[model samples]
Target: MNDHDAAGPSPSPEHHPDGVPKFDRRMLESLVCPRTQQVLIYDADAQELISRAAHLAYPIRNGIPVMLVDEAREID
Candidate 1:
């Protein structure tokens, strides 16, 4: 079986298929904050996504990103 089949179907960010950065879709449906599993909001001004429920902010490094909890910034 292919690796994808083993992992089941998941809507991964739209990459170049050749493993290159192209576009991302996680920004649209990633609602659960990785830290606290809370709701998240996109902060276009800061170019960083915020999780008010978790009181943390995840950065969009470069162009592609996965806002995992460990990499998130704590809010004041």
Candidate 2:
């Protein structure tokens, strides 16, 4: 087999290595703000989960979400 066949498709600007999408959308479907218990808006570019009700943005690092008030950033 050729290297191209083994490697499969090259990583796109949007995806990570090993053919895994950065942060699965389906998982976020059930994610909610810990404080307000409200739905969160996923920010793909910023890699954050925004909680409008709480006016906070939770950071997601290495495909894992950091869902902590202390770690969240206050938003306007």
lDDT of 1 by residue, 1-76 (tens): 9888999888655444455444354654855676777766766445567888888888766544557878888886
Give all TM-scores, in the order shown.
Answer: 0.54, 0.72
Model 1, runs deviating above 4 Å: 1-26
Could you say which candidate leads in lDDT? 2
Give candidates' CA RMSD values in order: 7.2, 5.8
Worst 10 residues of 2 by lDDT: 12-21
lDDT of each: 0.67, 0.86
Each candidate's number of clashing pairs is: 0, 0
Q: List the residue pairs that clash in candidate 1.
A: none
lDDT of 2 by residue, 21-68 (tens): 587778798899999999999998888999999999999877778899
